[model samples]
Every structure is written in structure tokens, then in C-alpha cells.
Target: MKLKTLASALIVSGIMSQTVAAAELEISVQNLTHGNQFTPILIAAHDGDSHLFQAGEMATPALQKMAEGGDIADLAAAVTGAGGVTSENPAGGLLFPGAHVDSIMLDTLTMTHLSVTAMLLPTNDAFVGLDAWEIPTEAGTYTLNLNAYDAGTEANDEIINGGGAAGTPGIPAAPGMDGGANGTGVMDGSSNDKVHIHPGVLGDTDPNGGASDLDSRIHRWLNPVARITVVVK
Candidate 1:
């Protein structure tokens, strides 16, 4: 009788351990830019079938708000409503270039995928995004490189006029304060009306009057603007 009781206890304990282990996940994000700053970032783990944003599709109102103004409240609420786990503004504020931010251990057993987004400062409607990455079941760390995406909700005016609201035509502010002033906008027309890879800022050398309000040499960047790592334990 004693032996049978011990075997049953061991089986129950093993089942509980597996349940606990499957619920927890760890995720980390890094701002890999050389000169740009990332505004408040939003990290979420949702159902594998759901996505925060998709390429070649119109930006959701929440995504547009976050991309244009660096606000993540709405996006957080949206993800929560869909039964997802979320960590909002993990950096508290701007994640400076080359800075790293880690999310608190997230128990996303039911949530099978992850998504992240943050606006890139000193540009109009440009954001770094990770959409619906499948979290592996094995215990290991996975790294991914992210690209800069244009929200396509506003023009790339590049004017730092403190206009961050949706539908505004100018950049909110240059967090680094490295942007120029008093110049014409970059492009009056955008070919893509949906979310797409950013064409990068078209900055000029002049600060007083030029085609762009950013310095060409200082603001330019190639693809893969951000990096993210997920550790499944």
C-alpha cells in the first residue's frame, strides 16, 4: 500500500511540474540602432492566429496611434481583450540606441506567439516591429532581427513640429535633439498606403533651410533596426 501511494504522488507531482513549466516564457528586446531612439515599446504574447500588425495591410487604429505618437495603452488593451499576455513600456521611456530592455518573466502558456512594436524617434511614422513570432516549446534562446516599418498613416514630412497626434503631418520630436530645423518636407506623396518597410529618412546638410529636417549622415540606417530574443523555459 505504501509503495502504491508513493508512485501516485510522484505521478501527480510530475504532471504539475509540466503544467508549471509550460506556462512561463522569457523575452528580451534590444534597440540596435546606431543613432536612433525607440519610444515606449509594447510587447505582447497572443494566440498564434492573431497578429498585432501585418505587412502590406492597413495599420490598425491602435497601431497607428502607437506608431505616430508612441502611445501603447490602446494596443495593450486590445491585446488583453484578446486574452493575450502583455508588457507595456518595458523601458519606461525611450530605449536609446544600442540599449536593451527585458520583459518580466511572462507566463504565456496559453499564448503561443509574441509581437512587439515601438516608434523610431526623429522620423515620421516610422516604427520597429515584430509580428507574431512563434514561441518554441523547447528551452532555448532565439534571436531575431527587425526592420523599420512605415505606418503609412502620415506623410514623411520630417518636420519636427511636435505634432504627434494621428493624422498630423509632422514628426513629434527628435528625442536626441539632433534633427535640423526650417526646411521643406521630404515627400508630399507616398506610394504605399499600407504598412511597409521604411525608405529611411531623407536628411540634408542644411539646418536652416533644406529638403529635410534631419541630417543625412546622422539619421540614415540600413535594414534590421531592432533585435529581439525569446527564451522558452
Candidate 2:
């Protein structure tokens, strides 16, 4: 009887440990850009089928809102409505270049996948995105590098005109305060009207009056603009 009881207790303990490990997560993000800033980030944990935004697909209205502007309310609502768990704006505001937000606690509770999104400041409809990544069942730390994505809902004119509203024609804001004004616009060369890898910014040397309001030397960036760390505890 003693042996049987001990075996049962060990099994129960193992099950409890697995449950705890599956439900808790600690996440961190770093902006690995030269001069860009990330808007309020939205992190979500959901089932396998859900996605914040998929490449080669059209952008949803909620996603377009977040990409054009810095808004995440509609996207948060949609995630929660679909039975997903989310943590919004963990950094509390704009995540500047080389800045890192650490130890964001998220109780994922039965969710198996993770997704994160945030708009890149000083760019039109450009956002850093992580589509449904499978959460590891093993208890350990994992790191991921994310790329900038174009929502393809608006033109990349690179004009800073406070046009944050969806379907607007210009960039919402330049948090770095380095953007210029009073110039022509860069034409949207790509005909792809779907979410795709951003071709980076077409910033020019002129800060006062050029084809773009963004500065080529100050606002340019390569791929893998952000790095994410996940700890499954």
C-alpha cells in the first residue's frame, strides 16, 4: 500500500509540474534598429490556427490600424474575442532603438502558439511582426529574430503628415523627431497588395525637402529588426 501511494503521488506531482510549465511564460523584446522606434507592442498566445498577420495575405482592418498608426485596441479585442490571451504594450510606450523590454509575464493557459506585432515609427504601414510561432513544450529559453513587414494597405510615401488613420497616405509620426517635411513623395513601386517583407525605407539625404521625409543615414535598417526571447517556465 505504501509503494502504491508513493507512485501515485509522484505521477500527480509530474502532472502538476507540466501544467504550471505550460501556462506561464516570460518574454523579452529588443529593438535592433539604427534609428527606428516600435509602437506599443501587442503580444498574443493563441491556438495553432490563429494569426496576427500572415505573409502573402491581405492585411485585416485591425492590423492595418496598428500598422499605419500605433493603435492596438482593435487587434487586442479580436485576439481576446477568439479565446486568445494577450499582453498589450509591455514596454509602456515607444521602444526606441537599442532599447529592450524584459521579463514580460504572460499567463498563456492552454495556448500553444505566440504572435507579436508593433508598428515601426517613421515609416508608412511598416511593422515588426511575428506570426504564429509554436511554443516549445520543453521548459527552456528560446530566442527569435523578427523582420519588418509592409501591410501593403498604404503607399510608402515616407511623408510624416500625421496621417495615422487607416487607408491614409502618410506616416503617422516620427518618434525620433528626425523627420522632415515639404517635399515630394516616393511612389509605391510594388504592385503587391498583400502583407510582405518590407523593402526597407527609401529615405533621402535631404531632411528639409526631398523625395522622402526620412533621412537615409538616420532611418535606414536591415532585416531582422527585432529580437525576441521567450522563457517557458
Candidate 3:
């Protein structure tokens, strides 16, 4: 009878521990750029072993597809397949500059880290990224500043052509429609083949014919293009 009682107590303890391990999080992402818009954002609560994109490393094909085309399907599938929780396109569509998407709820059962990603329009293979941030066990509000990363898969030609496919040589659709036209490409090749910090866009003054389609004064942005707030509950 004592053994039976001890076994039952152990089972109850295990269940209670499992419940304590789970966490609910309220996530909010804000676009801090002046002109650039973010494509559908992908937020993932995953284990420490998983990462959306790593600096100084070659980008995965899934990451390349997202950084180039603003497509998060592949990345979402990967996160879900790894037993992770994902919130895809929380903003419902393109997140314009100075806009914020709030109250995104994610139930992280066993995941220990968080990651975020989204393509920045009007640039070539540049995307906002947050890689493998440790989720604190203590409940509190945490803020993070995200930066723009160059996938290094394509050159920053600064063209406004609709070339979103991987290995393409131009920028995809510009949501603001503020981009110029009839501009020559910025560069023929990329200087780095691995993922790294973006050098930012190089726009010209001429709208009709210049070295780039982007406007240097309007489209250019410094680091920390996005801000993420996580509320641990």
C-alpha cells in the first residue's frame, strides 16, 4: 500500500512539473524603419539547437527564399517540424514603417529559445532577423532590437524589378511605391557569400536614370531596424 501511494505521488509530481515547464508569451513586433516595409513576419519559439539565420554562415535555401521573396512557408514548416511553435504573418500582411503588430500569443511548452525573421522590401536579399534568443524562465517583459541582415545570396542592385526568386538579381515589389525607375544596377556581384550585416541601400538622386532605383535619402536605414517586445506570462 505504501508503494502504491508513493507511485501515485510520483505521477502527480511529474504532471505538476510538466505544467510548470510550459509558458505563455505575448509578443509584439514593431517596424522602426522610416520607409522600408516588412513582409509577413515569422516568429518561432524553438529549442536552442534551431536557428533561423546565423551570421558568417551560408544561408539555407529556406532562409534564402524568405530573404529574397518574403515567403515564410518553408521556414514555418521547418519550425513546426522541429516540435516548435510558430506565429506566421501575425500582422496579416505587410507591416509598414513605424507600424506595430501586437498581442501575438505563443504557448511555448518545451522550447527554450525564440527567433524572428522577415524580408525588408526595397532591398536585395536583406531581411530583419533575430536568432536564438534565450527565453527567460522568470516571467517579465523583455525587449530586443533586431537588425537587418544581408543573405549574401544576391547583390544589392537596388533595382525595383519583381525578381523575388532565389538567385535573382533584383529587388521585389516595393510596397511604398516610392522607388524610382530606369536606373542602372548597383553591383553585378556580391562581396560576401555568407550571411552578414547589411551595408544598407545605395540610392541615387535621379529618379529616371541613376545608379540605383532606391532613394538614398528615403530608403536608407541604420541598424536596429526593428524592435521586438516579449511579455512572459
Candidate 3, residues 64-146: lDDT per residue as tens digits? 99999999999999999999999999999999999999999999888989999999998889999999999988999999999
Which residue runs does candidate 2 get wrong by more than 4 Å?
A: 1-21
Candidate-wise lDDT, in order? 0.86, 0.94, 0.93
Off by over 4 Å in 3: 1-20, 188-190
Q: Per-residue lDDT tens digits of candidate 1, residues 1-233?
A: 99999999999999876753455767778888878999998889898688889999999999999889988889999999999989888888999998998865788857878889999998888999999987777788888999999998888888988988888878898888888899877775777989999988888999888988888887878889998888777
**Candidate 1: residue 162 Cα off by (Å):** 0.4
Q: Lowest lDDT 10-mer window, candidate 3?
A: 15-24
What clash count does candidate 2 reach? 0
- Collision pairs in model 3: none
Give the candidate order by descending TM-score.
Answer: 3, 2, 1
What is the TM-score of each predicted model, taking all chains together? 0.89, 0.91, 0.91
Q: RMSD in Å for candidate 1, one decimal? A: 5.8
* Residue 187 displacement (Å), model 2: 1.0
In angstroms, give how far residue 87 of model 1 lies from its true place. 0.6
Better of 1 and 2 by TM-score: 2
Off-target runs (Cα >4 Å) in candidate 1 are: 1-21
